[model samples]
Target: MKGFFSLPGERLFHVATLSALGFLLLFFVGIISSLATYTDWRQFFSILFSKEILFAIRLTLFTSTMATIISMVFAVPAAYAISKTNFRGKNIVDTILDLPIVISPIALGAALFVFFNTSLGRALEGNLMRFVFEVPGIVLAQFTIISALAVRLLKATFDSINPRYERVGRTLGYTKIKVFFKVTLPLARNGLIAASILTWARAVGEFGATVTVAGAMKMKTETLPIAIFLNLAQAEVERAIAVVFVLVAIAVIALVILRRFTSRRQTS
Candidate 1:
């Protein structure tokens, strides 16, 4: 313990911090473990593998993956620009971009719901495609909610990279675009991976905005979080518990993957 925590503090500091950490961990774990009381061990697998649950899992994965892809497409360029450039109104632009993250998901969803009723939104939907209470709306909601978070994460990554590396690339007669692809991107790979995993995980767990925009229509717009809501609403406690475990499993898998990537990046 002495070797592990070598700061300018007494041994009591270690005990105090570790105690706080343990308390928090146990508090959360205890809450989750209590769900076992509602869970039927015999029916757990059957409930988890049921069509409704499977559909929710598939929909959750699909929406989260699509949203993540779209977000990274926008966030990478946006993060790069914000991190590497200085311009008039840059601070304002950054603040505006970050609004989606700071705003409540429920409010975001409500905003979306209101947008579709506007004349322009109505025309867009009428001429383009329907979005009100639809599958695409779920993707849109998740995208709006998490894209800003991705930008912030990737921006920090880009910020940490030495500008000297990019300058060196330029001195080698490389174009700006080519240098970005060859140098900056490779340097930011870990950050990009981390942002994608975190955003996707967040999308998987999004319920407030998703439900508000997409509505929990069981087999249709029912992602895992939505499925849990639906099950609990219908008084299906055991099924809800089963869905909880499934969500926990997904979150665990994502965290494990993120941890592995971080470890590999650190070692490399």
Candidate 2:
């Protein structure tokens, strides 16, 4: 028994087992509590499949996907730069990239609303300040919240890669962009995918910022979280619960995928 405890592998196995068991206990408790409150499963299922619910689900997926795609487009390169090169104010840039994570998202949304309701948003719109109370506002809010998350994750991914690989690519006459695509990007694919998944999950669940900026219009700006919030506020408990469950399921799936990719990347 002493020898078994002394083995590093055995100790790690013990720790993992303990952690998994703890998580399972909490998960099942929450499940039971939720299930006990729902007396009509069939009615709940019917509500879940209602047209309004379906529309919210579709819109949530669409907006989250769009926000994630936009985040990835910029995050990868910014992360690469921050990881690979030394430049003026690089520290400041990195700090700024992480600032959103600390800010209250709802407050951020309100500030954005003010900015856009005034000149900044109009300047950006050029003729579409209508975005403040529209779909674009929701997307923009989601994008702002999720983009910071993407940049943080992608930066970590890039940092995990050794710069020696890029040096080797350069030695072979590969351009920076070529090296990035052929080597760095491939190596960081798992992190990028994980980041994108997490970003989408975060964007989908975003409510405070979204509500403040998007002005929850039924079937117009109502994403899943917003739907759940509006339903609960109006005393539609069952519908709200169903939506919450769906959101929880989505969040669980995203985190599971993120973990799998992150684990595979680490092991490889």
Candidate 3:
């Protein structure tokens, strides 16, 4: 023990470990205190059972799921193109695809608001494109933010794969589309699922863009994050904490599932 402690790197290792443990302790203490105060165990248990919260949660889940699916549909092809094919202005397209990650969500929402409040919005008002200030707007906002991330992740995953696999498939007379679906996609399935899960989790918790585009209408556009914000603004501390706890729980479950799937994929 003395020899181990006397090592040159031991001091740094001890400091890092202590700092990590201290942060973990602070985190658990906060969680416990929040759960203990302003919240009865019974209420916490029953919060998800409430009709209004249940409705909001259902709407949130539905919208996020739809947005994630749509985002993945677009992301896969875009990522494949960026990773596998040569095209003019590819760098510009890649930068634009990833530009959302740098912009403020509130700013993005405000831009959407401005665009929708103009003649373009009027033209889209009665059409299928009336996405700004509706439930679809919420989906669109989530899609805008999460799809960029998905594209980044998918592009990385696609690049990590060797193009030679596809070439070999082609030599066997398989069409390009079939080669992709049968080979590339399956090989990248784990990464794709990881990306989708991450995107869904982000979508579920998005507030700024959603509120800007969807207007936080109760039982309509009131996602979990918006519920937290609305409750906080309304001075409903207990309800806000409850909603936050729900979001935390959801994020944890999603992370666990992602890890499990990723591990299984690696082992198989």
Best by TM-score: 1
Off by over 4 Å in 1: 1-9
> What TM-score would every model get versus the actual structure?
0.94, 0.87, 0.89
For model 1, the local distance difference test gives 0.92
Runs of candidate 2 exceeding 4 Å displacement: 1-28, 126-129
> Which pairs clash (backbone N, Cα, C closer than 3 Å) in model 3?
none
For candidate 1, lDDT tens digit of each residue in 1-268? 6655556565778879999999999999999999998777999999999999999989999999999999999999999999999999999999998899899999999999999999999998899988878999999999989999999999998998999999999999999999999999999898789889999999999998998988989899999998889999999999999998988998999999999887877786
Q: Which scores better on TM-score, 1 or 3?
A: 1
- Report residue 77 deviation for candidate 1 (angstroms): 0.2
Model 1: colliding residue pairs: none
- Candidate 3 lDDT score at position 36: 58
Minimum summed lDDT over a 10-residue window in model 2 is located at 32-41
> How far out, in Å, is residue 130 in model 3?
3.6
What TM-score would you give candidate 1 relative to the actual structure? 0.94
For the record, the alpha-carbon RMSD of candidate 1 to the native fold, in angstroms, is: 3.3
lDDT tens digits, residues 1-268, model 3? 6577676779989899999999999998788576657776677767767776787788889999999999999999989999999999999998998789889998898888888778877677667567765788998888888899999989998998888989998999999999999889988988898889999999998888899989977777788888877778898777777877788889999999999988987786
